[model samples]
Target: MSTFGKLFRVTTFGESHCKGVGAIIDGAPPGMELTENDIQPQLTRRRPGQSKLTTPRDEKDKVTILSGTEYGITLGTPIGLQVPNLDQRPHDYGEMDIYPRPSHADWTYLQKYGLKASSGGGRASARETIGRVAGGAIAQKYLKLTNNVEIVAFVSSVGKVAMPFVHELEDEEPVSAEFYDMLNNISQEEVDKDITRCPHPETAEKMKETIMQKSAEKDSIGGTVTCVIRNCPVGLGEPCFDKLEAVMAHAMLSIPATKGFEFGSGFQGTKIPGHLHNDAFVRKEDGTLGTKTNNSGGVQGGITNGENIYFRVAFKPAATISKDQETASYDGAWGTLAAKGRHDPCVAPRAVPIVEAMAALVIMDSFLQQQARKASAALLPSVEIHHSLLGVPPKK
Candidate 1:
């Protein structure tokens, strides 16, 4: 479970309060410009204490490129990356050596392993995602440079506060050119404009206030993040088992606090009939066959259709709250415990980058798989078989 992706695969290691945490990325092409500079930005974005709403851990999360590069270019080998833990206070969690936090992975980890870390959630900590963010940065750079793919995720809701829908497309028509413009070209700078990172200024303000209020009350809240993957090539996914959306959901739900995932019309699409839910094929201005409606998101029949792919992930509130709660200990002892640790009052804001990182991982793997399929199909020249097997047009 610690490893993710296939070809461009990533295996993340280390723990929350350990000396460091990082990832080893394999299958990257040689001679690509790579360095600490490319990875640090995403780590900083995912780090704690960026705002008062998040945990006040204050980790710099400075990453180091330990291997797989020389003179700032990749060597087509396994890349080893590390980020140190600068502000670890494991002693603060001594109370948890005996009693686990309610709703946290503490008990689960112990139950599975027969023992657990002395402090922090160990591998289950959000810090573990540091490696993912770093590795995903590489994937993002490659996808952007090669396919012009743009992946952006933002806080769509915090607690009960939510932004006004960015786009409310009708079933009769596809996403407008205006929406593609806004969604495709959106920058992380815009999403980070507010403390809550909700994109909508008014809603961001409300979300921040709600988070502050909850933190003050020693409570927490759950919310949602919306992500968009624009300018993706068509035909990325296995038709039978690894449907594009299914793999996407697998990736998103793997996140620590993620509770739910929905893409395209998702659950709401069920409200409409088959005709209305379907995305009709039409010709784009570029002469490529496209969808007149995009209720299928950007994928049809488990494959991408060269349109914007969008999804939403719901996050449960951080389980470690400062408020006291009664729960069972490892030995079946029941007592009141007020969790002692730094945790987000609402996870949506910091989770924005993680959502993007996970999305990048998925897209990167899909892109590589598609590339492999296309390359192998080139040697076989039966026209009918080629068309059937290589459903997507060859890369121009």
Candidate 2:
């Protein structure tokens, strides 16, 4: 279950308080330029102790490339990556050994496995995403080098503080041109300028204030991260059960604390009339068809349409807040449970890279699957169909 993807398989290991956590990436194309440097930036961005808005758990989150590279080139073997749990304090969670934290995985994990990690949330911690971020960084590199694809995610809303554009959209209204323009041009640098990572300066300020208020209350607040994948190749998703958006939703919701996922027009499209909601196609200057309105979110009938793929992921507030709560223990004994340990009051800012990484994983896996189909089809001889209904015109 720790593994994800098909051709570009990644298996993540370790736990929140384990010796270390990382991923092993298999099926990476051989001879691509790779090194620890290529993967560290994303990990750094995802790591704790970044700012006052985030957990103060001091961790370098420095990655080490253990194998699968020679002279900075991939060897087509499994690439190994790891980041140690240097600042982890297993003692901080000592009290949780009895009562499970409310809304956390502590109880379910025990029910499923009959036992659980004594410290931290075990595999349920956001620390599990370190491996995902590292693995996604490599997938991102391949996507960037091959197709010039770019994935950017930013905190769009924190608690009730959302960007004016996002909160103001009517039920039947399509995303505005200004929103599209922002999606087309926003970069990680701009997102990183503010601790809240909302990209919009004014919204980021409000989000920061909201997070601070929640942290002060020893409670937490939930928010959303919006991600866009630009320059995605056409025809990446499967036709039926494995729709592009379906797999993307799987990937996004797999991250800890995620509560919801939506892409393109998403729920908004349901409120619009079919005539107005449809994305009418228009031929581009490049001779390929493009949609005038992207209400389809760059995908139609489970396949990509060579447009920017965008989506929003909602992350529930961090569960392990340092506040007292009324909850029952493993044996149904009710008691007050006050959790300890460093945790984010709001997870959307830190979740940005994780969202980008998961998006890359989905896109990379889909692209590789599409590429395999094309390669295999290229090897087969072409057959001329002569049926009146199905026959194609003869080659010019």
Candidate 3:
């Protein structure tokens, strides 16, 4: 199924070179103020031709809200959004219809579906994610209004030019207007400027130089993005069935060209013994129990523990490049193929927003689940409410 989540489900559609792509969001809370403008910024961040590190495909990625919204507010119904695929170069992909790109989903989709859509990987294209991003924008807004939860993700590694010390990224709020401006305002013409999308000036410059050199060689590189979730409340997961981490991993891996994913203490946790790796609980100044360390990544037993949750995602270099490579045609005849497309030599930069989008979708679904549980719990006859509290409290 192309849909995900029990509540707040999202269904994505459209193809890479098609007229347009879009998503249908079901279960969004009604009456929330929504508009095309609210979702456009996220799409703009993910669109092509916006920077030097990504493809030069000059897509406006302009989105339209077709349904589920009225009078600039969500009707609490399914939100249907569309992103027209401008700057599509179907002619460039004409020959590719018969020849599958190695390491792409072409051959796999053919094997699974008996035939494949020919234009630019059809449904498998990263273009399909425009819808996800649009839908995710709505989810992001809900998280902020309901829980003050904030999610942020950034490119931390680009091939050899990895950003220093992932630990340096503390749990922070989602990007503000200033942060977005900082990202876009940086001149790509300043070839000596930053790379890897790291906020640090020197490293960004090195990363940019490396990408330019590699793109000149018609090759590509891979890297990672780390996402942080802050102010996530407790009890936002379903244990033994759909664990939060399990769902999050699935969502992250669904993005095209994603190679690996790991959350707090992931593989690195194995390097230390329990004594060092364990997150010791401590009382915080806020009068809440907090972990001295976040080895658990803010989730324990498939539920949030009111701490920062973070994870890293690795993306392989864009497979479609100008570099010549060996492959076969649809007839299984051997041949060499050099891709022709306005492809990104490195995808890490644009992927930052996508990572945050997916994280928001996942967390938003969990947030809704948490709310439903609370609403259900409050119906009990003996439930005691504290006059000082704004929400339902545990039974006394």
Which candidate wins on TM-score? Answer: 2
Candidates' TM-scores? Answer: 0.93, 0.96, 0.89
- RMSD score of candidate 3 (Å): 5.9
Q: For each predicted model, how many residue pairs clash, with residues at least 3 apart or on different chains?
A: 0, 0, 6
Residue 11: error of model 3 in Å? 0.7
Model 3, which residues run further than 4 Å from truth?
A: 167-195, 383-396
Deviation in Å, model 1, residue 10 alpha carbon:
0.7
Q: Per-residue lDDT for 1-396 in model 1, tens only?
A: 889988988899999999999999998889899989999989989999887888999899999999999999999999999999989999879889768888888888887998898899899899999988998999999999999989999888887677654434455333355544557677789988887877788888888888889999999999999899988988898797899999999999999998999888777676667876687789889988998767688988899988889888999999889998888776789888887889899998898999999999999999899999989988887565454465776655
Q: Where does candidate 1 stray beyond 4 Å?
A: 166-185, 381-396
How far is 343's C-alpha from truth in model 1 (Å)? 1.2
Clashing residue pairs, candidate 2? none
Candidate 2: tens digits of C-alpha lDDT, residues 11-41: 9999999899999999899989998889999
| lDDT score at residue 49, model 3, on the 0-100 scale | 89
* Model 2: residue 186 alpha-carbon error in angstroms: 1.1
State candidate 2's TM-score.
0.96
By TM-score: ranked, best first = 2, 1, 3
After superposition, which runs of candidate 2 have C-alpha atoms over 4 Å from their true positions?
A: 385-396
